[model samples]
Target: MIPYQKALAALACAAGLLTGNTAAAAPDAYPQQPVRLIVPYAPGGGTDSMARALARKLSEIWRQKVIVENRPGASESIAASAVARAPADGYTLLFASDSTFQLNPLLYNHLSYDPDKDLVPITRFAASPFALFVNADTPVKTFQDFLSYARQHKGKTFYGSYGVSNSTNLGLSWLSKQFDLDMVHIPFAGQGPAMIALLGGEIQILFGNIIPSSIGFIDQGKVRVLVVSGEQRLPNAPDVPTFRELGHDNLDTGYTLGLAAPAGVDPAIQRQIAEAVKQAVADPELIKYAAETLSIRLFAEPSGQYRDFIADSRRILQQRIEAAGIGKLDQ
Candidate 1:
């Protein structure tokens, strides 16, 4: 007869294969081992900033290492699906964006895992408004100029996005419908490539986050921001008008980022992690990094309200998708 330990190992392997729940530490003790915090994008972006901050604080508080793993692709759905399939033991968490949880559902035809059923929100961390940027040499200087150029040039113009059906893409789609613009969408593998295309003048404009690359280009006078996608102008860029201030409320959209564990995580564990995140985002260094460097506003809505926020965002995204006639991508 096989030894008891060998038999248990065989059973665990079978369970993993059957349910797609990879091996995980038992939940009774909550994280008795190292925890993985998965980010859907590469390093040096806003998501990485928030994930690293929470990982550091969670590690210190829990006395267990919280590793930040980058799994960038599919507009962050790759990492979200992986986390959704992980064992519900609070050891594997997704540092997900609104694109991962809200937009992907309406964008993709068939997802590997049900986001609502597979992942549970822990805590919301931030909301990042996008900037409407154009090349410095472009004749347009302000949002009004952009509108006039689009109306005059129509289909001759092109815009770039990190991916189709992403937050930026959806926001641009809403803008096109509202303003009757005939611009074309040019997609890139990621934000870095999109930024490169923008600099090369392959695309006329890009609606993207105010990250290091965008900020560097803006400071270098290579590209300029015409508007921001928040209710009010950003403190750093007070001259740039918001969509709301410009009387285009539908274009006033920003993406949200947060941490989530696979559904069925113990309520107590979820609350424990949420409480920890609440403390982490409050760190002076983290707050400074989010605001001064990344230009992202930090958010800390309670878990229940966070879920409501997700639902509301999803509803709005669905309406935009339908109104714009954006088709789902084949998986």
Candidate 2:
């Protein structure tokens, strides 16, 4: 077995081959060479760790080398464009978060790659919800308390997110508009930077994924989660209420970690990739890591369902962008 084949279960969102049955493995002849999985985050972060683990599992399943190359910049567009321009021969795949596809399109007016036209959805590797975290020094404790605090501080309150049109950005923006508050927005290249800002007191609030990277801060009380995204509370942070229970259903859940290949790949190859994802996702250790360590839901959601999610999420994200009155970014 590969050295990291038994590494912790991970987060990955996938849209598999044209709605076909679960594939036990990739087609025998497809990956004759090492497959490169591009991750759009800095090393040592939770997303990068998960991607590396996922790559190892793929190496085992495909019986070939799966290389993970980190290209963390421009809010994932740098790596995305690299994959978009790579030959669509099933060797180059992008492992990205929800924002890479849905949010980046809204933020950048001129992008190097067009997500709709240049990428093909393969299969979702993992899925999770977001949470709102406030710096420990902030006097807010509960969701309602945070709302009241925002209203009290008004323009003085500062919040951080990965970038404009990021779910964290949109989530807080939507909340502020509805509650009639004027909070300041601070955008970072990625969550890791925003997280650091939260810890350093440079920012007071950060809405981030409920992943390993952010969870540690919450555990140490460096940050406090006032609200989560799902209908139910989380395992690690059971004290936090979900946005759904607070009557914010739209923000109930999302933050897909999925796979994608450049556009125009053969449908058969897409299926092969999806099959590998399906097989890897079904591994017991991966499933355990997802439910326990990661506090996420793991599944091999296929391409058709994945497309529906993208279409549905795009509309919701568009509405949020317009409502937030955010100006487009020039990439």
Candidate 3:
């Protein structure tokens, strides 16, 4: 029999060769099977619409089934956690928003998965600017006018946000703190309900996305947009002023939707998914759909850059949540 040391050395050499062969045999052909794109919201919302639009475009590009599954609940926590637990094979992805990877972690006391540790950013698909609107009959015509009226009304100035810890709520809280106003916040199930409450005179102001479904109301003189929260004016509402121009430079909160996969996915597969996403967003049909339906600007940043962006956004949102003193949920 060979000596123990010689036998161990021989075993190590064989193991190394096997490892090299396995690495060389790894397939780079991504999406060999159907890809599941998870949208952490209800089926009819903006997030779902965008996810379906992306899935269609990706299907055309890959010539494979790109399925969109809606898992809506717990402020998008359910869907996010599902994706985090999915296999790290790049076949499953999450179409996430600020609520999932940013706000939920800061606002909840317990989470099934840590976004920073469980998910890897792939790309940012679009950014939807928040619009502050009032009923068309309201005397407030501009941001300045609204501020003046809010001050005079004292606690009577009511603003409707989607929920307590949603982007709309956080943004409205920041604006209220900055302007030294005591506006009462009314939370609704979603932006649709919040806008409905505003239209029915149950609330005076609402912060929401500018979807095409609501454009008719604006054109019909039912809702008047006072200002939009963004660094630049929106193309759909060019005349609307930005919060920065109104002297609230720090009130630039908008919704950014992106794709993320469970961490430890093969880097090559991640790159393939990111490239597919970029190509899908660039397609003329997809661009037209985004422009006409969502009024969202196509802002696609690559996976590496998107990781940095998510990190920065998480920090900013955490600071806001703490400053606003939003109560934590018990998970």
- TM-scores for all candidates: the values are 0.85, 0.85, 0.82
Candidate 3 residues 1-331, lDDT tens each? 9999999989987886877534433435567789999887656556678889899889988888999997766667778889999999888999888877778778888887788899888888798888888877789888888889889987888898766657888898887877788889987656666777888988889888777656778998889988988878877888988888878777888898899999998888777888888888888877877866776778668987877887798898878777766678875
Q: Using alpha carbons, what is the TM-score of model 3? A: 0.82
lDDT of each: 0.81, 0.80, 0.81
How does residue 245 of candidate 1 score in lDDT?
A: 85
Which ten contiguous residues of candidate 2 have the minimum total lDDT?
A: 6-15
Which scores higher on lDDT, 1 or 2? 1
RMSD of each: 5.6, 10.7, 5.3
Model 3, C-alpha of 183: deviation from truth (Å):
3.2
